[model samples]
Target: MTHATAPSPDAPLEASATIDGAEWWRSAVIYQIYPRSFADANGDGMGDLAGITSRLDALKQLGIDAIWLSPFFASPQKDAGYDVSDYCAVDPLFGTLEDFDTMADAAHARGIRVIVDLVPNNSSDQHEWFQEALAAAPGSPERARYIFRDGRGEHGEEAPNNWDSVFGGPAWTRTANADGSPDQWYLHLFDSSQPDFDWSNADVRRMFRDVLRFWLDRGVDGFRVDVAHGLVKADGLPDFTPPVGAGSMGGQAADEEPVTAPYWGQEGVHEIYREWNQVLAEYDGQRVLCAEAWVDPLEKMALWVRSDEMQQAFNFPYLETPWNGPALRTIIDKSLAAFSSVGAPSTWVLSNHDVVRHASRLALTAENPQGHGIGPETGDRPDRELGLRRARAASALMLALPGGAYIYQGEELGLPEAIDLPDEARQDPTWFRTSGERYGRDGCRVPIPWEADAPAYGFSETGASWLPQPEDWGPYARASQRGDADSTLELYSRALWLRSTHQLGLGAIEWHDAGDDSILWFSNGPITVVANTGVTDAVVPTPLRDATRILASSPHDEGALPADTTAWFLTP
Candidate 1:
């Protein structure tokens, strides 16, 4: 934890040479924890705060600077805690507020910062404000906090607009009156149980500001703003159609310009972040705010990370880029330029709770589209060996880049998506909302395997897991990989250790002329990183041929790197 002080924003990027800084997030590796799937402590088939507290040491040992926990806020268990009922309270299923304090204290004691998920775009319909709005008449103050409008039909039978939910249905859900008659229709861009907030309303903005203070007072380091770009609706909330094949949950083609949907990435959201930035500035330790803004075109995404706004934004363009070398190079260049333009650091993420794990993603063909989950009925199964190889290589390449990065839970163990879970065991709303058209994200959210031979893979004391785990995951268990030098877990540990010790994340990139389009070779200070994405083994770039290889994603020939392999070397 001992390192130099942070440099000023205008100072040279190379001067920020260590993880220790008021701006610690700039080059830190943050691990994402999907609570219910991380570990279950209560024997109730659910992961709780105490479970997370008990696991902090493992994360500390993994070399992550912080941990980003998905929503554990009070909710009706709809949308897996994303549909929040109370912003300031912890859900009983997870733990009490005291439990949260204990977890936060535990993490802080381990020198790990905590970033909680903040779902501001919407709230559970059961939330007090939403319920009050439901009981109050239309146009009342309670209703004003949310988007409530009269329907197009005479009896308010029709929805307010033709918008479809991101979860795959109409965005507007109509309500019934006390007399069982049709009432006002409310907007919910996600599930019917979660109603969108009206940022245009002063009270709504004030409430969120207070919520931010609540956590800040409780010593939480930051928030991962959920749907960060969707807080404000387009003026007039006009009817609009999303461009065909448009995706907002990341994994879109890096070159495509995402059409600004009426409900997403409006200019007003900037004002919201600006206000939030002021609130964060009031605290010490450079408390950060990372936006989950899936907005398109790296330029647009950069706006969310301006000096007066958020500190970091997820580099979805980089994550979405294919495994092709030229494409990755283009994205890395574009992302660095974009974030630098705003004086903000970019965040590289390979997988998360909302998408398929990168291991499976890298192995799949174009037939398995991004954002869609796979199941037993899938026609084209991912090539497990190829997927993991590419995934490990991707991790090495990402770690060598000059910015912050995120490692989703179990990713260090090289876990692939459990694509064959029973239909009845599924819990993601996207599954039922799409009526089996899409398998949903449940495949990637399976419980982690802590011990190879324990019941439920050591997820819970009662051998119960919220989601069913694949029986064949023993080889991928963390315990099985802990001592193996070749295991993905150890690979990540060594890479992270090397990354921190070498300050690779703080170094400016200098691309090497590889002469081959499929080879990516770059120097970050004293470290050289090379990846071979070609179909055949490739000779190491001549410029770095004499450099000693320090770490490699796979076993390879003496002078050549295998396809889908990445290696790090000391710059000589």
Candidate 2:
């Protein structure tokens, strides 16, 4: 490993030696592990906390600074762990709280902090709070846990708002009283099985604080707050006006109503975040609190990361933008400018369990020309080389960013999307409700590919994985990548090692317009990253006058890269 020394001029001249509570996230690289897909310990073909504990060596070898485990809370799995039935206990399927304790202890011993996902906006219908709220009398303390209203008066015949659930259908679900009359309606912004909590209620807020305390008391490091912006909604029930050109974009329609604004990033939500921050601070800076805010406008995104709020908010633009040279450069420049304006630390991600995998999204071949396509035939096609090149290029750019970087599970192995699920086997409710237009996230949620020849690729030694393993995953398995020096796994390791050894974490980012539409050039002090997104080679302009030391390349070539390739250069 290369050793990097702090520059004399770059040294911080402060007198105090105490570490900042929020400093843990700055320049940290987080590896996201979807518990159910990472490893299976009980031979149930499903990953558990114990399974994750067994894999700490792999994470350490990858040079990741932290691990962000998706929700392992007790749930009905309605939204794949997003709907929490019990915030204080680990689900039986994942493992007991003891398993979590062991995992946390082991991770910390290796200098890796563990940040678990916390969903505050919604809870499973089976949760004690939600169950009691469903059976409580009007205006009772139990009823205050959620947004519940009586059938009489203004609440009758109309919903509190015109908002729709993210999964599809009405946001409010009406419940009948014992007298056979409509007693009340409850709000759920995601699924009927997951009801939204009322943040306006002081008691409701306290409950979540206790939940955070529960985890912190157990030695957990921090949390990644889920849907941080969706905690509060507009106070008044209002009608939603669809934006001009509804459904024009092949995605969800944008809501143009005023209620939609406050419903996402309301001013009231910050108070809740501040309260949580205060509680976390008492843990002596050992814990953290990051947010999963979906808003892209820099101003809106920065709201969750202001000094008094969350330590960091996930950068959605980097995750959703098209993998092109010019487009990616603009995103990086805009994000840097936005975060700098707020004087807050930022977080970046290219793939997560909820979205399509980056390799399948950015990779392209003659057989899968559109690049969004996936399946068994995708691996062996010679044209797929371009896809692998693009995947590596994107990784190089992500690691070179100034803030925290997140790598989703299977991304290091360059796993493609699982697109061959039969209709009978479809599991994701989001795609099922959308009538298959969305293709369900099942493609990205499939089992992780482990050994190349093991039955079920070693993801399971039993029947089959919860989601069927893609037949094409053999070539991209862990064993295959382990043997190939030019594999995507090696590329990710090289990029990660470079970031660790070069103190690239503390450097300032300077993006330069490379003049060509296919190329993007960015500099972190003496290091420069150039990515080629077009179908042809383009000259990359370097600001430095010396020959660039080729530190890492996606194609493993120090020479000029082909289209869809990315290269990192260090000053010798």
Candidate 3:
């Protein structure tokens, strides 16, 4: 856990250096690909590995540095591949092991590094281990791999604890024995179909260790550790009492202490990552481990990325921050400072497969803005134009910051949540677990648009997308945006290009004096990024008002930055 003290923002980062030509991820612009919705090659109405391999060229052309792939491991698809049935094999729903190898080779050929999801916290109910655990007598070794315990009530009738599932309902589910009697209760922080592992067990630790080596040896570049902070529960399966009310994304309310959460950010989790760091160091590619921790107080989140643990952790607070100037600045400054405490680089993310797409969520000026668990209103349509404008601006501002960034699959196309899907078509476990009161994240999981008019919007050759695509998506299709200068896709491409060729991601960002609450202006070296989230047009501030205009989220003509616009400039 030892490293040199963090250098000042102006100094080059030691972690950003090349180790046998593997310094790409330090300031890399990584893209997240949700397999089932990215594209479908065999026309099974779902995206697969072969389809992903075929589209590597498009991603390469997108000017990104790497790809962070969600799970495609063997599974029952109960959690869409997160509930892994077999850690070493590919799920047929996606493709075979050969398909994964081909996809890896193709991605490398295009200079794009591959980082797959690692779900060490849980396994599908259908997995051989879980199946054996289900059939074995209580207190057997098979049951030890999972977190199985006898129920607490008389006659073992009730669940072991009162903890709630992240999806919904009780966290513990009872298992029946051959005698038709309730045997034991197993813990699943998410769905009952995905049983949580007992990290304290030696076997569980060894199994995940082997799984990590299996992927690392497969020529993949890294892993995005799913539920990275939830590996080890508190000493006892304690009742999680939030200081105030309940919450998700680490399940802490605004005023709740982050590190004290019962099921997350435990001290034991670091030992797991410290060992994982050794395994990553053995590989040649500077194979990284990125945590999907949602812990807050930024300093607590920093624990996961200390020199010996994970290389990076997602900056969820930044992703969830509102599009206000002072609010965003506070989160940004705190995030940078926190990560610096550990001598690690902070990773910025906008939207991912698990949340509502930022394009639409940022446009919500009404109730429940995070778009978590809320379905679309019966007769309301989100402000598509407004959301896209802000998303574009946010993208520029994110890329201009000093660290790595992640782009969800369709962010570049200005895609919003597919809110109009019929209730019957929804598939998130949270929806069913909550009895339809919670919509879950299916809205953000819709298949992406590639061709403007092709069948299923070019998601599948058979014109069948696993999740329905909206009709309005045609205008934002890749075909329509590829050469269009004003398209969000191209705007992202240009921003990434500037980011890659310059020292923007490695340098400090100093605040620019715009003197307006609605606008955020910041300078990185000689380049400046100004974002106006207000409702009125804004004049660029100060002596550089007439500086050379470069890239913009929306068009800037005659020296005026329109509302919800972001523009890049050269500080003359």
Candidate 4:
């Protein structure tokens, strides 16, 4: 059930005697960089590899251990670079391979590891393989790399089955036969422009393995596997309805925990990773693989990170879980127990490019779970005061947990979702395919503000934001909050610094007052964390009363914490 080699105290990358590099990911704080929205260079109004290289100083100052860059692979940009046409080349819009090397060089120079996004489940329809598949006749070798099937109807106009695209509409797109009649259908779980690859094909398997090597040789520290749970489909491609309450984030959430889906979690997927693990083992940088899976039940998610599989998996359930004290505590405990069973550390996350900014989503409950779905009226609004306050408290608690953490760009600045972007400015295909029913992820992808009053909030020297920025963004710009003691950015920087230097990520967590239900109290070695989720102020518990109050999410004098606050204490 568990096979990973246990980490030793003397392992590499250890910040001190407390944390080790052998399992650096266990305590590492990784920052997710959506290249397009991170920073702009070349006056193209688009963030590029060069821009990322230029900003390594900012990232180093943030106290993060690594950067997870979203895809910059050669692509049609139909799905904002997710539809990759070439696995080895960089998109011209984001600069060339040399720029990526410069970025990687700069990152490694500052002790920051670089992890690139890898989309192996699908490729752009314009890919050479797909183009050859199109030119070749039916049942040809060229078509074997993709999931192409014969249509069922008389005119062969009908899709192969009832599977629907995650974006909306039919998953199967009928392609014209050699005679110009719609005959063969290809599967695309996302936009039609992205054709799903057939993992069963030997060529597909060998090709991706080579892709991994191409980047590994380029000094990449690791990869964030896209659609990590989506390569293997069910046998026969039978039809089934997705249970209600399925997840809307990237991949489908289970109808229930430990979900059973024909499309996700096929046994073959693990074997693929086993092979990948072997590839990573050949590299020497303590290189790792992290899954962007939407799997459910913390235990189910752990399968992706088995001893010989990936090293980390996105904690979507924790991200989707509500802000209630009990719920948060339960998920955290469950995640710890699950990952521990596999000899891997659990990861904590609150926001990413695909989801709404937690600072704004914290105010949402089950009844109002719409994340960044803006309408003409009352849609682009959340109680900012309440949401931002809770988000701050949660961050303190999140960083103190006994494992790794991921920080979404702009989140450290308390940026809210750019919900009011006009329809024309929205870029996610989910918006166009769903006919606007789903506002898509553009709100969260808005370029981050770097200066309080500069043009384009200092994101672009040309004042040309690819996606328009809201006027309010100026207040949360990096320049405005950089050194403010109580600012979200400072809170995050201090939290990460403490998490690493104190060995908090290495020890076990002892719950202090979990039974109280309205509060979460726990201790990790010398670092202690407490959060008050109740309406009224919670008295500092007895054991912590004598401890040293090192920091707090909200402004407060020593020992006095207001409601909706999370505080850190150093136990003697």
Candidate 5:
């Protein structure tokens, strides 16, 4: 609760000597709670700030050092709170600003820090800034808050830039004049409702810094800057070249028109992040700034966390990599190398509000219909037990890594994807725009099941949830797993305890690729972790000979990891 006095601009900023301290995030476990779906305390079928505040003890019991709440800022919900209408106000649906203050005070009182998501690139059309920009009054300051242009003729028929929106479609949207003629074009890196701000403008930068200060003043710990890399773009808006093959580098098929090259990761982004970090450094301990950057190149990712920039940038490569042992090992090794090269602390995220759940991704295939079996020939079906084992395994591996680890809500419960949404029930904008090529994130966004027979699985009491709760999720609810000694919840608790009590997953990481598809091996000081991504059993070779049994496979055997199991050990 102690606030560091603001340092004078003439004084040197004291960079954190080490990631260790009251900045619990350094060696902490962050549980990401999508406020809308975490718990609906009002019984209105929507999760609110009060609901989250009520769950503080549960989170504390889970042993998470902090809770990264997805945006609850005032918005039209066009992008599910990502498009802010007012950075200083809380949305009515979530609760009032006073409610947020109550939540923050409660969380801090319980030794839990609260971090909220801040999407700087855009705001709702309802935002005062966007409204003023649209009006474009003479010499108005609001006009400078966003990127506004005269017309497409000044650039071209298409967007001045070849950048594609992350939500599918053009990054530029055409606006018409009062007379109905083409008047201007605005840049939107995600949705048209979320316009990109002109970071080049000093006023825009200052305004955003004030926004940050506003939240910090409200007693919130920090922010997770959404789409942090897309803040800046190629000024020229040059044409982009597509990859040679049909799919993206992440192994997903490309749907848009072929281009010569992508337009992300421009050099100007570094200065923008540096300035943000400088402003954030003015806060006290645990006042962190983390970036949600999706850039693949290690150098680009490093730019967001290069000491003078962000405290942490998400390591997304690990999220998309195949769950095979060798693939995971390569990712961990490469990530450590990259973070070390940049002299910044690393961060690992298994899942978030934006992506598919890890359990559903690793389990629930065509051959393995019920996700609980263990066999090389189980093929591809929903293997519940296997999924649970793998969930534990992924947690163990993540905790054993050298950096901070993020856990999406319900991941610890080994929750699977909701498979029964009718077409009309789908609400994800991505699925609507992409013609269902991608399954909507509704599966992961569904209501959190809290009990076996409680109405709507304890998410709400009166109405049905915005998204249907998965049938039979009762077994995975918190009430069901809380007392079970061998449940996935217990495993996660043990993993977190190990990380905090022994610092096994803290400090530096050294990785060794065992050159096998079935196993991923890495060491942090004396602690080592190995995960089996394949269905077949993998043997730990002599290179791992120094390992002593610290934690082993649970509800399954050691040598054979049952598709997605993980194990850990310590060396003398």
Candidate 6:
């Protein structure tokens, strides 16, 4: 059921009234919502479609053009909602099909477009097709829909290849016959519960096309293709050797590692996107397909966003770069040039459901690598104040860039990762698969805080949350930050308003020579952004020193830009 809320006095009446038509996505500011942690409407300790509907007003107030929801499709929740059992049905835990329609309607009424997560790389083992494949004979047509092959060793006891699951262990799992005798082995690039689909099968191709249409007909604006480069695999399923610095079996978390294995970024995947693009064209021209591909080399990554393929691919290199001015500038220039080659707009993102929040990450030195998670046992604790300062400055710089941007939920509140999550509460598959050698991603997935004093920080009605929120998050709650002029929330709100009014997304950047290695400056239309990543304060460039006006600044420095600060100025 839908649980609509009364609009706040400060909320915008229409979400995209200011957005340019047909090319809105070219420079739109999209917000990503991790459904289970966004809001809980039924007091079930889990967020549902109704909860998302009730919060549309808040999102409108935040000035986002659209919302990209993580998967809420029918699933066993083994690897969260990524392992889908049914593509066309909503998971009961997240509400019904009617609830999704209601939510979509509410968002549209506010002018906010909706984009859903699409996991086409694999399906849950419990899916009927996979079940059928398991029950059928070795060479039966039912088994052809999935990748099932004979084991290599005697008695069919060995795995087909040396590939490892991204979660851990062998990529292939053995199945048994009715009499408990070993039969064929199946390939699973992720967890054993997710069986890979055989794109070689015409049935698989047709099925996914129908899935895209199913959601498009129901009003979803587009899809954020998960693992967009993983649908195709190398022929003959050859053995893989881990590259230098690559984790064991060449399998590592997609967020931190560049996907370079034989199973990822194969040439055939572009053909899949070409076909999907044709499907999206049948709907609204404004509808988009974004790729979550972590492919390396900015040039190679650009292929996913070619004119005939996806509209945008996440800029992982930009996001993964360290908090240094020169490093960031190099990445920005390369990203812009790479996407320009394909005539597609680059997309920038700092945090997401898969990695640590930038608020904490910015404080850690490059010597201390960020692993799957951080907990009580973590040796290198983040310097909270420094992290938040750099995080806020980073946000200012990212927003001023000339392209589309994504804001992960809670980023506006300057919320840091829940670094102290108890080990018993860890739920990410990475943790269990590695036998707790890594803490996993549970820390960053904690629920957002709405009210400071309310139960579960006002995320749920019954004082319950799927992941425990940290006690110190009270001051960071939306209720506390909403009206504070100096708060991170206000900074984002004002920046976005300026971005829309000035058409900054569609603007082109003009680089400025800051004279200092630690200083970076660029002009986009009437706005000039200056960022200083050095330890000492730096003088504003000659042109910007006498600028017509100051639009915004992270630390609100005077006379000169402070260390680790980013400022936007208006030039005549």
Best by lDDT: 1
* Model 4 Cα lDDT, one tens digit per residue, 1-572: 11112122123333546333447788778999999988888877999999898787878877788999999999999998999999999999899999999999999988999999999999999999999999887788999899999888886777888987888788989888678766688999989999999999999999999999999999999999998989999999988677666654333443454455677778889999999999989988688899988776678889999999999998887887777788888888899999999989999899988777888788755333323354344444677888899999988888888788899999888888776789898889888998888887888889999998887898888888889999887779988887677678878777777777786766679887645798888888888888998877867777777777777888765556678899888877
Model 6 misplaced stretches (Cα beyond 4 Å)? 1-22, 247-259, 366-371, 548-553
Please provide, for model 3 over 1-572, each residue's C-alpha lDDT reduced to its tens digit, 9 standing for 90 to 100.
11112122222212223435335666788899999999899999999999999888788777787899899998888888889999999888998999999999989877789999999889999989999999898888999899998888788888877888888788899988788877889999999999999898998999888988898888989999999989898877777655554356474555556546778878899999999999889888578889998786788899998888888899988988888888898899999999988888878999998887889878877534232534666234568888888899888889999888999999999998888888988889988898887788899999999998899888898998878788788998898888677788878877776676566767788886688878898888778888998889988776656677667888766578889888788774
Question: Candidate 4, 427: how far from true, in Å?
Answer: 0.8
Off by over 4 Å in 4: 1-15, 18-21, 249-258, 366-372, 375-380
Residue 403 lDDT (model 1)? 86
Please, what is the TM-score per model? 0.95, 0.88, 0.94, 0.94, 0.86, 0.94
- For each candidate, what is the lDDT? 0.87, 0.74, 0.83, 0.83, 0.71, 0.85
Give candidate 2's error at residue 406 in angstroms.
0.5
RMSD of each: 5.0, 5.7, 6.0, 5.4, 8.4, 4.7
Candidate 1 residues 172-191, lDDT tens each? 98898899888899999889
Q: Give stretches of model 2 more than 4 Å off.
A: 1-22, 150-160, 242-262, 363-385, 540-552, 556-559
* Model 5: per-residue Cα lDDT at residue 108: 91
Q: Report the C-alpha lDDT of model 6 over 1-572, residue by residue, as the tens digit.
A: 11112233385644333544438888899999999999999998999999999988888888899999999999999888999999999999899999999999999998799999999999999999999999999999999999999998777688998888877778999999989888999999888999999888899999999999999999999999988878888999889866645543233343464557888889999999999999999985578999988777788999999989999999877877778988999999999999989999999999988777999888876332333667688777899899999999999899999889999999989999899888888888878888987776788889999999999998997998998899999999998988777788887887787787677888899998988879988999888888999999887787765674344455444457889888888776
For model 5, the stretches where C-alpha displacement exceeds 4 angstroms are 1-23, 137-142, 150-163, 244-263, 364-386, 510-517, 539-550, 557-563
lDDT of 4 at 325: 86
TM-score of 2: 0.88
Local error of candidate 4 at residue 475 (angstroms)? 1.7
Q: Write the residue-wise lDDT of candidate 2 on 1-572 in tens digits.
A: 23232122222222212234537678788999999988888888778999899888778777788899999999999888888999998999999999999999999988889999999998999998888886778888998888886433454977656766666567788877778777788988778898889999888888899999998888777899888888887767455643543221012222332223445767788999999989998886546788887664666788787777777888876776677777777777788778877777667788888766777676533322111334433453333455556677788878887888899989998887676777666677765666654455677888887788887787776746788787888988877876365677767776777776665765678777777877877788667887778888655454433446454444333345567777677764
Model 2 / residue 152 / CA error / Å: 9.7
| Model 3: residue 114 alpha-carbon error in angstroms | 0.4
The superposed Cα distance between candidate 6 and the true structure at residue 528, in angstroms, equals 0.4
